[model samples]
Target chain A: MDARSPKRGRRRHGRFDVLWFLGVPILLIVAVEIVPMLGVVWISLTDYNPLEPDSWLSFVGGENYSRMLGDDLFWQSLLNTSYFALLYLPIAIFGAMVAAILLNQQLRGRLVFRGIFFMPVVVSWVVGSTMIMWFLDPSSGLPSMISESLGFGRLPQLLQDESTAMPTVAFVAIWKYFGYNTVIYLAGLQAIDSALDEAAKVDGASALRRFWHITLPGLRPVTAVVVMLNMIQAMRIFDPMMIMTNGGPNNSTTSTVLYVYRMAWDNLQFGYGSAITAVLSVIIFAIAGLQFWFFNRRSVER
Target chain B: MSVEAKHVQTPSRGAAGEGRLGKVVTYGLLSVGALVILGPFLWMVRSVVTPNEVLYSDSGGGIIPRQFTLDHIKDAFTAGVQPFDVYFVNSLIVTVIAVVSNVIFCGLAGFALARIEFVGRRAVTVVIVLMLAIPIESRIIPLYILASRSGLSNSYFGIALPLLVTSMGIFLMRQYVMTIPRELDEAAKVDGCSSWRLYWKIIFPICRPVIAAIAIFTFITAWNDYMWPLVIIQSQDMQTLPVAVGNMAVVKDQLRWGTLLAFSLLSVTPVLVFYLFLQRQFMAGITSGAVKG
Candidate 1:
């Protein structure tokens, strides 16, 4: 019995060692990510407010979701987020593609130019937003100064004005990410065989013709990645809008994530906030799934 | 003869050279693009050094500032609700702890997934990838509740906990660990090394590059993180640099442009400098992470 028990204990020790390696991370992911996700789902069904310590566990089913259905501000914010994404996706994709092609050339100082372009990606979003705020400030901003010198009047306050705030924010978002996309596309570009371009040239094809027929098609996979990532990222736009406009000038720039922040923290409406979060999460997942399926199918067909 | 020479030059230029004019155009376009990209940062640096009054003056808005002063830098460090030093320190503490936790926990987790034979390893990897799809912002509400419920809110641990074991870090480490030879493990085991010792002595030391990548990425993400920190940390004293700078902008009655610029500069300098030195590794980390994902 003593020998048998010792062997059994050794077996148990081996199992325990495996758990020791995997346990902490699994527990962390459960505690931090998965559990919170489930909690968010549960919280959406309740009207519990943390500020009121006594009523922390109260439940009200479907009311927050129903309220969100009737909330114009909620819809407006969602639309604003979509608008920002639509504006950003095309510019980011096209600009990154073009810039990547340019930088991929065998120019004398291309590396220096690549570094200069990629500077904004390394800068923090908060800092970039602040810099944008200052640079577009009507009183003494560079844009305003340039406009005045060029015989144009003082430029409009882009951030404060409702008509331009979202687009302005979108532009800054594009600028911040353009370099990152450029680098990714450059990676894609470099992977393409130079022989393909050479063959097209041998066929008496012009540079534009070669680019249109050969280069663009070769970039399909990378383009799919860039587009999917950009769309998902743009949909979750929060930091720039939160920092720059605070969803202001008539709620023009209030992204859905920012609205979630406002609902939960600013107003202490945890139920409503989680309701929006639940819905937004589903929508984001759906979009990502659709992109994945589309990309996967295309690649499979190719 | 001249016509034939011109014809030959034209075809060769079209094939390879793109000509002097083409070179001129390419350089011009690249220069303009660079200017657009770096223009705001230059303006930011100018505002940091330029006096506030001059920054506001119509004629004083140029790439180069005429008057220079350190008053704004001084004010940035000294003149806030909680001074900038406190914010810097808070950010430093949170980021340091986060980096350490990520390296250790993710290193262990990654080694197991890559090398150890265990049940549910596949399930764990699948879970990690799935978690990557869940945006942190969507989970922030419940995370905040969890932190508050556990009495972790407003503490350094609370700020760093959610970020301690990022899925990307685990995935990165696993990929790096998988590239290390299996023979090393066998060699270590032959010398009386246990699994834990194999991981610690053999695996960990060889993973300096991946560890460096994880450390840099985590440091930058933690330092620049605004939303989660804003939600979790409510105290004036516990605020990180981004949160502090954001609050300073909103709460302060007078927007001190120079001071704000200086503060922005201070917040960005560390990561920017780190990025410059380790640019290749940073880019490799990003690209490799994306490709693997």
Candidate 2:
């Protein structure tokens, strides 16, 4: 009995050793990810500037939040980001669905098509943004030259024009990201059983009816996942806007992230940036919670 | 055998004319979509080979030269240019360290999160989910302050450390690892193997597919990351690929379209090759983690 108890103790000690491997990294992740996030929240309550002396700063609760409420750029950014999400989400998701359905059909040279679409996803956003920038350049861009050729008149540099800047960014985002979503949808489509289509056919269903009744319903889970994923991605868009537009012409295309970055880095208003982050986080969490709620509802309904 | 054969074979007439029209339309739309998708890349390549005079002259016309030259490609690195070789190297070193560390640390953390029944697991999962949602840009300022305080602002460790604890990585590994049966752990335990030894000797090997998936994802993400490097690494010698291109654009006044395009294409080659080599696993990775999120 004594010998057996000692063995059990040794086994317990060995099990405890596994904790060592995890303890440090878990702590580090908490420190870096959670701690700074908390700092963002705290700093939102205080006026802390990285450039100014620490002693010169003062705590002003809710002032930054109220100021943000009235800040013109903040509202503009909110509008732009919303416009971006509104335009890109439905169009890109619909486009990807269409693309995925088409590709799911029996076709030759399909691999080449798959590879072509997937290329943009793999390409860095920086490269894509720069290429798009060149393609849209006012004087020497390909679009301008094409317009001239087609006798459509010289195209205004879209990125430079405030009227077109936000849309232009959205267009690029769609182009770069649709292929990724399409591939996911393709995987989802493949998972669907063919038996349902056969049953619908045997019931003398029309092609359109078959699609509406069978295919679309089958793709619900994937569609939900795609919509939520794209929402978050589209909401946090910054690099492309920063590189291509710089919130430019007249802050036409600035996003929340870019605004926050400019606030923190350019204006040295760390506290205000933190406040923007807080607001943005709340909005994101709300959207994500809505997605989860909808998802659970669907599952329950089935 | 005959029953199976009959089950496998189903004779059917192809769809009628209206269906044919639908197929044509679908294919046509897909073709146009492909053109839209591949257009920029083709133009990016064409502009590299075509002289600036021709590229700027014609837009939609076929610009692929019957005879091609490496002049622009050469000029990207040679034209009394700082050349991107150094940028490539710096990016490579940083990406390697970051990817390697993320793979190891995230794997262990993921295993713990997935397989280990311990206190605070639910909280850890919640934290990871929330972290994944919070944009990294939000925390950039504070992260910068922390790095500076730790004297890690410009070093490899500084750039690599913050990224090492990716919430996506933990989530990915947990999802993949969860699919494996706990009975495997029990079986190993019955074999008189310690838990640490079981993980090192058994579980790690079985987790290769997930590891590969994570490794590729982490590497690509780190490779393309521009914002953090842009803020932290101030010097030219320490610049990554995207930073180099950004700095080049700033310096050249954005007029050097040909050279800029060439540099852009050059920078994406390693990533393009990496994708081609691991196409299957990469699709799996993208769908499993990034797409779901």
For each candidate, the alpha-carbon lDDT, in order, equals 0.82, 0.77
The residue ranges of model 2 lying beyond 4 angstroms of the native Cα positions read A1-15, A52-57, B1-18, B53-62, B65-68, B79-81, B250-254, B290-293
Model 1 misplaced regions, further than 4 Å: A1-13, A54-56, B1-17, B58-63, B251-255
All candidates: TM-score: 0.92, 0.91
- Give TM-score values for chain A, per-prediction: 0.92, 0.92
lDDT of 1 by residue, A1-302 (tens): 32545553333225567788878888998899899888888999998699776554788889999999899999999999999998898988898888788777667788888887777877778888888888887776788888887889778988888889999999889888888888899888877776667656768898778778878888988988887788778878999988888998899999999999998898999989999999998987887788779988997997
The prediction achieving the highest DockQ against the true structure is 2
lDDT of 1 by residue, B125-163 (tens): 888877777789778888898899899989999999888
| Candidate 1: residue B46 lDDT (0-100) | 78
Model 2 DockQ (Cα-based): 0.46
- Name the candidate that leads on lDDT: 1
Q: Candidate 1: lDDT of A224?
A: 80
